[model samples]
Target: MSIKVIVADDQEIARTGLRMILDAQEGIEVIGEAGDGGRAVELAQRLRPDVCLFDIRMPRVDGIQATRSLAGPGVADPIAVVVITTFDLDEYVYAALQAGARGFLLKDAGPALLSQAVRAAAGGDALIAPSITARLLSAFAGAGRSAPPAQPVEALTGREEQILAAVARGRTNSEIAEEFHISLSTVKSHIASLMTKLGVRNRVEIAMWAYETNRVRT
Candidate 1:
């Protein structure tokens, strides 16, 4: 089945480019396009695409707000959102992540990465642009808030701890599986267990928790 996607960007060219790239992929489809955030939300609710590709800046509404409405903490049924933006600022990345975006990508992140990100989001995984991943996550981890003395993780086994550390380092599930000489399904099982143990919604949140809890070596 094709992964249905909605492309929302104020720029016609950007939307067109994204549609072209996504549509050319075998297992992905560009189901809709919205020139503004308001319409993006409306279309998202109506069409219920597998993933929403949103640009940060838009007229009438903005991508972050749209993301919040569709996937924020308060949402009852959150849709996966992949924020696509021209900027790579940490603030933008942080805000989008806070708004519950499943993935983040710069406009020039290329067709391969863009497609990979969409697939990742649709598959209940998350990806952040590498250029901003470590810096933004680390900054968020160390940004002025007092770290908790330690996060209680007696539930996690040694293998789960290793997987969590790899996730915090931005390693993909496949990479983690290869690194640990485990199957991909085993990596996913460990991640699922880690999330349950750590009380995180997604891999991004798990990474944040690892950093904030001082679980990852800086």
Candidate 2:
């Protein structure tokens, strides 16, 4: 099935550009567009698309607030949201994540990465900007507020540890496979094993634990 998406941005040009990019992909569709956060939230609640792409700054309400409304921890049925913004500051990234954004991408991350981020968010993965991920996660680790101290590393095998470290570094499955000279299925198996061992739901939580536990340095 084609992945349905909603584009929410105050600027018409931005929405159009994103739509063009997503529509060019064979298995993705842009179902709706909203110019403000309130409309974005309303449409999201109504349409229930697979993914919602939101800009940080919008009239009436902000993307963070909209994200929280749709995907916050308290929301019984949370929609996956990918926050697109011009800012790469740690505070903005952290705030968006806290608001339940599944992924973060800079506005200029290009169509390829933007599309990948949307698909990743929909698949319960994360696709943070490389620069942003390195800097922000490093700072979050240094702040020492995100993760608890490293517990026993568990019984993770060598391959699982390697995959977990790559995940912590924000490397996608394909990238990890390429880097390790392994097949995509093998990479996924390692990820599944790592997730089970670490007791995490998604890659974002794995990345968070990596930072908090000081396992993968920024």
Candidate 3:
């Protein structure tokens, strides 16, 4: 099935460009477009697209607020959102993530990454731009804050720790399997164990915990 997407940007040109790029991809479809955040939120709530591509700055409401409305921590049924911004500053990025945005992409990140991010978000995965991830993670780490430590680490065997570490480094499951000379199923098993122990919902949260707890540094 094609991944349904809502494009929300104040700029007509940007919406057009994104639509063109995404429409060319194999399994992505642009379902709707909104010129402002209020409309975006309304359309998103009504359309229930698989993923929402939102611009940070918009009139009436802003992308951040729209994101929170659709995907915030308290929302019972959160839709996946990918925030697009012209800047990669710590505040904006952090706010978007806290608003439950599944991905953050610079406005100039190009079509390839934009498509990948949308698909990843649709798949219930998260993808931060590589150029932004390290910097953002470092900043979050250096702030001396940590996610609540998980008791599950004690249950993780050494091999599980190794797998988790690779995941923390942003390695995909296939890549982790290759690195450890294990089968893909083994990688999945390790991930499942880690998730069960740590109470994380997805790989991105796992990676976030690794950084927050000082277990991994970029």
Q: Which candidate number has the best lDDT?
A: 1
Candidate 2 on 22-74: residue-level lDDT in tens? Answer: 99988999999999999999998899999999999899988989998998777
Candidate 1 weakest lDDT stretch, 10 residues? 142-151
Model 2 earns a TM-score of 0.82
Best by TM-score: 1
- The sequence of per-residue lDDT tens digits that candidate 1 reaches over residues 1-218 is 99999999998988999999999999999999999989999999999999999999899989999999999998998999999877666466667777889878889999999999999899888777666666667776745445552464557789988988888777778879899999999998988888777776788878877777777855
Q: What is the lDDT of residue 157 in candidate 2?
A: 83
lDDT of each: 0.84, 0.82, 0.81
In angstroms, how far off is 39's CA in candidate 1? 1.1
lDDT of 1 at 80: 99
Q: Give each prediction's root-mean-square deviation over alpha carbons.
A: 2.2, 2.8, 2.9
TM-score of each: 0.89, 0.82, 0.82
Q: Residue 138 CA error for candidate 3 (Å)?
A: 2.0
Model 1 residue 215 lDDT score: 79
lDDT for predicted candidate 1 compared with the true structure: 0.84
**TM-score, structure 3 vs. true:** 0.82
